[model samples]
Target: MTTPELGLPMAVPAQGLPAAVRIYEVGARDGLQNEKGTVPTEVKAEFIHRLADAGLTTIEATSFVHPKWVPQLADAEQLFPRVSELPVALPVLVPNERGLDRALALGARQVAVFASATESFAKANLNRTLDESLAMFEPVVNRAKTEGRHVRGYISMSFGDPWEGAVPIPQVVRVCRALLDMGCDELSLGDTIGVATAGHVRALLSALNEAGVPTHTLGVHFHDTYGQALANTLAALQHGITTVDASAGGLGGCPYAKSATGNLATEDLVWMLRGLGIDTGVDLDRLITTSVWMAEQLGRPSPSRTVRALSHKE
Candidate 1:
């Protein structure tokens, strides 16, 4: 029997898309945060190293939230120093002033603050009102900026929320604007529940632009719960968004939102981007190997479709 060929897709250049895309890899942090069993700190460090070796320039290393909130990432201090020598950008998620201070003390140059658009999510996830959460972030963002760190603000539920269905574009825009105004270098709009369609993605981008947020400063973080992540990403690309947040092997869901599912898989996003003739600078085979290894460590098969298909061929 003849062996089947495992090859890359034919490059079909898509118009109106950027020549290159910056994939903000989040597997180490967001991916492992929701795991039922704790992933060992050494293994998590190795995962980040493997991702950087696969050519992902921006990798979120870990979160500095309190151990009570996310016990999985309680080893942020230990993990950060282990992978700090990597040449890529290692952005850690900082929930507030305390988290930011922990990251800064460890020489982290890039940090991200996670925020919510709706009042319900703000209260549930942050134990504060939407405005109060923003107020809390104000000091964190300002301090990070004062220390010369590049801050990224992630606005969750930009599309829809389980408790608050169908988030208004204006509502999302307000949060985005607030973050940008607070000195965030970029904003990642997250569809936490994966309920956004292509049109919704475009409409929200348009609204942010109309509100004076530049397309260059926006990134899209879509969940594949309803299988709309890739579609929504294409819409964002068409609107001139160049930064995208994807998790390796499709790992991670919002711990606060039960309905939120895994993030858009890095491998899947790379496959589509490669087919579109867009550059992501990732070694697909290497990334697949990393995800497969991570899945082995977790004792489960990877949820990424591209990882499954390509790894099978290997």
Candidate 2:
């Protein structure tokens, strides 16, 4: 059969139109970690499997932060060992060198580090200043390199913060450049409070790209607090970002920032991308099913629009 001609997404001279984009599923870790209740270890593992099956290339499996901070993910060690092996990448969050040690002990080959764009967010979430947090990450990044593990960095509140509204472009750029220079494989700029608009996302990405940061090395993690997650994502895509961070059913929020809410829903993102003729390699029906099942496990309605819509039809 002849392929239908399509042009809106644009084609690169050598690559043609990029059909597939990588999605780093963050449900198991970021999604469940912020829930008001605890999710059993077995349920977490099942969700991870479902995400992998949905064609997510990278899944943030868990975090190694102190159990006291995120009691919901206290079973990271046990759950990681029980997950079914997949060809997809499985990365987890590690706050510091000590957290990295625990992740490494569990044979984690990929990990993520995080630093905040605002001093207040850093102090509240990590109990350190922005400089101190970056300083702490240096050792962790170096350790991960020495251990032959790939590292991705996160700069939270890239667009806005609850305590410090409207984060400056230079602040976001500085943190992003630092993470890249520290040898992180990629840096995900987070709209932690979901207050950013498409204009903000476009401007920030353009500024960073013009400063010599390749667009492919950047990813977007936008929360849906203001109903702008998908719009921001499209702006990122237009700027050549190939990876997006999302959580199934839109689970998770910032405990320190009450205004901050669910991360972009994986089901919603997949539906949008598919509609745009972008191939994420994810099965939308399966993804929605997983979202509904996950919401049932948590005993709450899913925060995903797509999941809610689809579930009602079924």
Cα-lDDT of candidate 1: 0.94
TM-score of 1: 0.97
Cα deviation of 31, candidate 1, in Å:
0.6
- Mind giving the per-residue lDDT tens digits that candidate 2 earns over 17-122? 3467888888888888888777889999889888888777889999999899989888988898877377778899999888999999988999999789999999
Worst 10 residues of 1 by lDDT: 1-10
Kindly report which residue stretches of model 2 are placed more than 4 angstroms away from their true locations once superposed: 1-17
Q: How close is candidate 2 to the true structure, as a TM-score?
A: 0.93
Off by over 4 Å in 1: 1-6
TM-scores for every candidate against the unseen true structure: 0.97, 0.93
Over 1-314, each residue of candidate 1 has an lDDT whose tens digit, in order, gives 12322657777887788999999999998999999998999999999999999999999999999999999999999999999999999999999898998999999999999999999999999999999999999999999999999999999999898997999889999999999998999999999999999998999999899999999999999999999999999999999999999999999998999998999999999999988889999999999999999999999899999999989833
Worst 10 residues of 2 by lDDT: 7-16
Q: Quick one: how many clashes does candidate 2 have? A: 0
